[model samples]
Target: MMITLSLSACMLRQASLCIPGPSRTVLRGIHQSGARCSGHNRWSKIRHRKGAADSAKSTQFSKITNEIYLSLRPPASPDPALNPRLSAILAKAREVGYPKSNVDTAMNKALNPNEGAALQSITYEAVGPGGQVGMIIECLTDNSNRCVSRVKEQLNKYGGRMSPTAFLFERKGVIKLSLDPGTDRETAFDTLFEVAVEAGAEDVKVVLPTEDVHDQVGGFEVITPPSEVSTIASSISSPFKVIGVEVAYLASTPLRLPANEEDGAADELETGEGLGDVISEEVADKVFSLVEGLEDTGDVVKVWTNVAEV
Candidate 1:
């Protein structure tokens, strides 16, 4: 009698296993004849990486599309020139390479709601693991029940739970004004402060560009009462462009991670450097993950957190 075995194509592609012939039975133990199939391994890695990239792109596109739809609703104009919010969103869509087709579709849907379920805006509040951190999540969705369930799932997944976190924040309007190229930072700040104050802005401060690779220029962030957002934006003089305006829930008292003995002293020393508040690297990462997870849910439009800094 003779015994033989054959490896499947898929198994062979993962690892090259060999067994000696009968004559060399003593050395019959299975051996890896070669390293893992490089071609197969490489392709697998490429596929996974591409999948992740595609997922991120899809999420971004969805968020942008929702924003476009919201901007086209009543009280907001479909014409970009007359609607600052819509204008800003369109600019952002272009910057992000959101397909024109999607934009057109969202606009059509907003213009003709009878063709689909009406979208609703909902806000959910949550507290972090230790109740030290609070978050405000804003969502726009056609299915409120599904949206609420998805949000709650994400919250529980990250050790968070729905709670009344609204009291921890203050609702106000934020306007981002772009500065002219080559403007002196100090002079620009002074001018912005003066003009913003005269125009009913509650506070004005320099805001650095976000993490977006395409955004290279920093600007002035103006805070105002919700009613004054439009007034202040229009009141801004030349050399500055009103890039974005939105009503947002700003944390009244931002929370910092409790400093441990090892990093506490170091954090205290750097406190005067304008770092505001400090969070442990580990906790910060979790906080960020929780926020991102919420944002990835199609309905979530914005996630506001009380965390001062990572």
Candidate 2:
């Protein structure tokens, strides 16, 4: 089996600035085997602001440093508007409870003349315990050694090992759309169908729902092959909000794990437990934590795993 596994900044002058915003596995007891990142939205031409934070922890400056000098190599602009990836990174940072001030400092430093962070692309390919396949973990980092070490440590702890055929996932386009709750579900479905057909989006998933009763609509995630993202965005009407758009890895084919006797195998097609139900929360947390730590190392960018605990 195999598993494949695979953020932000801004600033204000003086006191200012702020901003905000799965699955696969191979087989039982099988040793792991072997993963690419593809995108043309180059981010090397934006201008970044100067960083404001000095502390090590809880500092956007550090994150930005990781991005520019470590993750975002080549010292490009930190402007999210121009850098699609950075733009999403900023949004993700905010969503994760990152401080606004820290976000600013990171952006500020990326554009600094003295701060030279060389952006490098990294891809990790590994197999899992079963016959499951894997995908590439695309990352931008400054310290390849630290990133690899951290990733290896986590996988080894999880009863999985990084092997040499996990490239089964095809990188796809990602579109985060803010769903309109006010609209009827049928209307929403209509909107989705219209936009998807016009823009060529592949699928949609529910991310998180808004707690606000009045807010009605929370949001839905839209996915497309990397090539069709722009067309879908173009087909969308302006009243609907476009949260973030970028290229990301998505499994070309999904595999299900066995559960109780009721569970069906691939041949059944209509019957089977998805990875969501089979993977333990403890395992999820561990893997996610591993990802977070590697991401922090500033070199490893992506983690793609096909591991599903049944």
Candidate 3:
């Protein structure tokens, strides 16, 4: 099944990518196969057999339970758009079939003054295989050491290590305009180009890939680094439209791996689509195992990878 990342409103919730001034939520769900919304045919479900290759069903459940609690705040209108992050969290939770009672209990706790726990968002940056630059792995957590250990272990086992790689990827605030027919592509595109340039946009791309050029939901993705996120967002100065904003990870220089048909599961070496055989499935398993275990620690947050192989 597709793993949904639904959380309540208060705790750790939604995919709030950076858009200029502050972070804005893109909704709640995983991008195993990036979709426009939760209502889509999830390819990840088909990619992984039997829910998970491993039998850590119980352990995974426990971790998601914590995530739900960490996702929402107290009480809810139960709508996502009005409260995008929380709404998405609930959607993800339901998709996972988390107990209804557990969901309700979490809502109740959000309003419960006695239930006070502040979760901190943590991000880790590291260099991976092939001298490729890295990504920022952001997570919501309460501890740091636990997160660090998991990171170190994975890096050592994998073909890389961590350091101050936050600068490797330019950070920025972004607003993804998923326009409908009502929104004109030409006008919208022209407006965005103007607005983004004025806002100091480092980059922008029409996420929908097609020849017809107009049948996709993913719209123009605007990028701005951290310092300019807020400024650009405010200067855009719109009154009513929902211009979603959040800091996002953008590769400074994308690496293309070399395809080696003999080794499809390529490793650290960055190459074009088929140039390399990726890191072995076993290695991926190890990395996921360590990452998931670290996630359960509740302190370690976010993991980014340029590990071309896996």
Candidate 4:
């Protein structure tokens, strides 16, 4: 009798741990996947490490350097206090492990027009596989032809084509903020929304905890009109770490797959049984590969796409 009682208790305990209202197969799958219900976990640690390494690499360093140079281009003072954008870019450069010497050199070039090559800003649009994905590539280069050629070459190589994606993507101001450790979620969100609306923001998105949340650096994504980004970002009060203030290409609508190409079953939606999507791992990998190929171009700084994660 005691043995049977103990077994019942054990089964009940395990059942309680399973995601609410899912079958045993789902529970088993979650277990096999090694997913955790809580925010802090081994997966989170791995993601954080990967993000740090990626940010400190050559491409990221170059991007930050360009940002610093461009931020100082308005004939504004190099003193960060005088140019908030300059301050933000410098902070980013330092965060990415860029050398202080390099930072100073870039600033000097920006300050003295004759000191460096004249670089122009260029944007290229491309359509990805099945015209389901759209991308906008922003580049700062001294040679326009070289930049365009490089971009076109990459697009052709990756089954993408140069086309106008502006209709699909609109430029919006994005302000990202990271929630401080131990902060109350409700309070933080309330404060963020209030500040954003007051400062002319259009929408606020809570960066949902995802398998990639482990890789994400920020906790919230705030959006506003292109002209209002800086003002809105500056108004958000502290305790929340403001990550970046910039203009980005935000998709006006999602790109949906045809029924035959649709990945994953309706049952897998919000199952909490896995770290990522219900889509077969193969499709997800292909999508990311296409995006990464575009971003890897020497002159490509930012690549925005409308590809929806399945």
Q: Per model, how many backbone clashes are there?
A: 0, 52, 62, 0
Per-model TM-score, in order, reads 0.72, 0.56, 0.49, 0.69
Off by over 4 Å in 1: 1-55, 209-213, 258-279
- Compared with the true structure, what per-residue lDDT tens digits does model 1 show for residues 139-215? 99999999999999898898888889999889998887777778775577656656676676776545444333433
Question: Which 10-residue span in candidate 3 carries the lowest summed lDDT?
Answer: 30-39
RMSD, every candidate, angstroms = 22.1, 15.0, 11.7, 11.8
Q: Which stretches of candidate 4 lie over 4 Å from their true place?
A: 1-56, 73-85, 209-218, 256-287
Task: Report the C-alpha lDDT of model 3 over 167-246, residue by residue, as the tens digit.
Answer: 65655555544455456544565566566665676655443322223333345455566556544544442221323445
Which digits, one per residue and each the tens of the lDDT, describe model 4 over residues 237-289?
57776657778886666343222212223112224322222233333334445
Between candidates 3 and 4, the lDDT winner: 4
Give lDDT tens digits, candidate 2, residues 129-164.
332445355566556776677767765754456665
Overall local distance difference test of candidate 2: 0.44
